[model samples]
Target chain A: MASIYIDNWHIVLAALAIFITGALSLLMQLGLAKSIFIAATRMIVQLALVTLVLAWVFEQDSVWVVLMLLLLMGGFATYEIRARQKLAFTGLWSLGLGGIPMVGVGIMVLTFTLTTVIGPEPWYAPRYAIPLFGMLLGNSLTAVALALDQITRGAKQRQGEVNDRLALGMSRTEAMLPIVRDAMATGLLPIINSMAAAGVVSIPGMMTGQILAGADPANAVRYQIMITFAIAGTTGITLLLATWLAVMRLTDNRHRLRLDRLRSQKYPA
Target chain B: MLIIKNLTILPINVERLELKGGVTALAAPSGAGKSRLFAAIADLVVNEGEVSLDDVNRNDIAATEWRKRVRYVSAEPSWWGNTAQDHLSDDEKTRQMAVRFGLTTELFERPIEQLSTGERQRFGLLRALVDEPRVLLLDEPTAALDQDTSLKIEAELVRLAGEGRIIFIISHSEAQIERIATRVVNIIGGKLREGKK
Candidate 1:
């Protein structure tokens, strides 16, 4: 193993700058200083706890430990997605339906296509598996949650217009497709932005860390590209599934919106 | 008939109201809780109240079924769908309804963000009626339109009510109430009183 010498203080100072700048922007734009503080605190505590847990898992060096950690990450992501959207139990089921498949396929690609491995054992190497799985699941969770949120809200808001289409004898899916497509694009913008900014504007954290640990620049670039591609694939599939599942569940067999399911009571009487 | 009895809403408190509907216009000054009363009867508001359609209690019916019986349109229609066309069904019946609301082929192809306010309001009202709901609740439906468009919307509402669908309109316009309202209900100081019965 190569000795990794990260200047902890330097990282802390940079992270502080990022956090303060983010908080200032939120305060100015959204008037949400308190919310920014709460969210930043959440990010800090969660990441810190995950770091400690990861240290233990890495040291134990067991396949089971890696599996457990990965599962925990996925579960946390699921909970966060549902909570952030204020989704009901229906959302819970759809998150699993949408998220788990992407995670599975990502794991398969990483283990079999990217490296020479099959089954749970060889795939559990913490140095490789943890970061890759974390990256995939984290991106998938955001994409799925965003798609679900936008589509569900869209379906309800456009209920009338949708019903007019339905009255025109449009199929349920047909009535919903345009909005679903739009929501899918909104969910995808983040990944696209990340890809666009990866090399020219900013060196990605993963690539920078790898280079700092003395990996060849070419090898680090190659890994970064592969990981980025995988994340994009995972996020795209998850967005499609999440939007489809959410829209299907919103409508009944006849394609009418189940308005009772929406938590918002914004409709004028 | 649309029946509301002893429907008490809070925050914006409406102590009690009893009414049977026939083109009833709910007229109130701005922020006088007329909209909240409609929302309460529709069971869309979270409050302690009893509402019924015929003999069936509004709260007892499955929310979806109850919603199917009554459609509510806000002053500012919720623009939740991804595109303009997403709001309509693929069927010709719905398309015809969209045409009735003045939606053209180009409108269907355009995103909702590009739609004019008048177009969206018409679409909102048409959407409510097309579901064939027994009751319709409209909040400031013509508030944003020109005189001719407003008259067209009122005519549409009158036609629907004439077909036996109960229609309740909340309007700030006295002329609007006179034109379409069979009976006007007035709210003042948080109390419901019959106006020009």
Candidate 2:
């Protein structure tokens, strides 16, 4: 591999950028000192842990190991999807509405990409699977979180309209059509914007990383394009499914606004 | 007859309520679950009970069907479209009703927010009436309108009720209740009790 390997000292040295920023934020009383310091430390710790775990899993190269890591990532993503929203479905709906669509879409897209597109040997190769699943899960869950937040908040804000429609005899889907459309837009916008801006606005992360690690620019660009398409497709389908489930939860079979399905969130991210 | 049996939808506990065709004015203090009752009878919210029209149970048909036959109009209407016309159908009957409510054809074309609250309330009722429900639960239908407009709307309601449709109205005005109600009920000690008409 024509990769430039960084020494331990390089990473330690790299962290100084965050240290300086954190110090300046503290000294200037910008009030972002604590958040900056914590977030920087958190990123470093998380990345370091990932590196160690990935290295071992790759060495072992077992399907179970890949699955364990996948589950771990999914668990974290579920926790994140929950924390990021201000309203939650009362009981099983929180998962039934939010978790299933995200994880389901993530796995299906990742599997398709692995087996067919990238076609990594064995189809479960940690080297290919873990990184790809990580990207898919990250993008899918962020879209899901945004969509659910928008949906739950929209249901509340448009309570009068929804109820009015329901009382006027609109079905659950019909009553929730406007809010669901709004949520689909909210969830899908970021990924769509990123896709729109990919090459011109900035070299995407994957392409940049690949070039820095000595992959050919043409190969990197092609891979970047594929990954972007995968992410966009995954996010769109996931949001569509999640938004439907959110509507099912926010309204009822009785064509009424089931505001009771939503609980005041005790947990905040 | 519209029948509510063993209904309990938080703060609204009615063992049973049966109404034959006439305007039955529901008079109660604010926050006494009058609106909640309207919601429960409409099968909205997390309500536990059985509501039936005549002998046809609400559960017998689809919820949309049930709501079409039994409409509930809120005091403040919500508008999704920019103008009143967006929601109202362009039918002769709807246009006639709009005119009866003192709402001009151009008024329906005006932006919903720009219209007065009284106009919005009237539009709310008119929108629901397009479906021509059998049982109407109007929660403070005339709360926002002036005396003259309120009387006109009340006359419309009474005329509708006279046509064998059951009307349940929650009105804050005792005078309005006495003027239009053929039967009157009051909320006393967390339960509904029939009073002088």
Fraction of true inter-chain Cα contacts (below 8 Å) kept per model? 0.00, 0.87
Q: Summarize candidate 2's per-residue lDDT along B64-119 as a digit string, tens digits.
A: 99888999888888989999999988899999888888888889899888999889
- Alpha-carbon shift of residue B34 in model 1 (angstroms): 1.7
DockQ score of candidate 1? 0.05
TM-score of chain B of 1: 0.91
Model 2 pairs whose backbones collide: none
Q: CA shift at A119, candidate 2, in angstroms?
A: 1.5
Q: Can you tell me which runs of candidate 1 are displaced by over 4 Å?
A: A1-59, A63-123, A137-269, B11-21, B78-86, B89-120
DockQ in order:
0.05, 0.80
Best by DockQ: 2
Worst 10 residues of 2 chain B by lDDT: B7-16
lDDT per residue, candidate 1, B1-197, as tens digits?
55565567643445554445568888878877777667666555455666777778876766556767866667766555666566556778777777666667777767777888888777776666776788888888899888888887777788778788888889888888888899888886666777994
Backbone clash numbers for all candidates listed: 20, 0
Candidate 1 TM-score over all chains jointly = 0.58
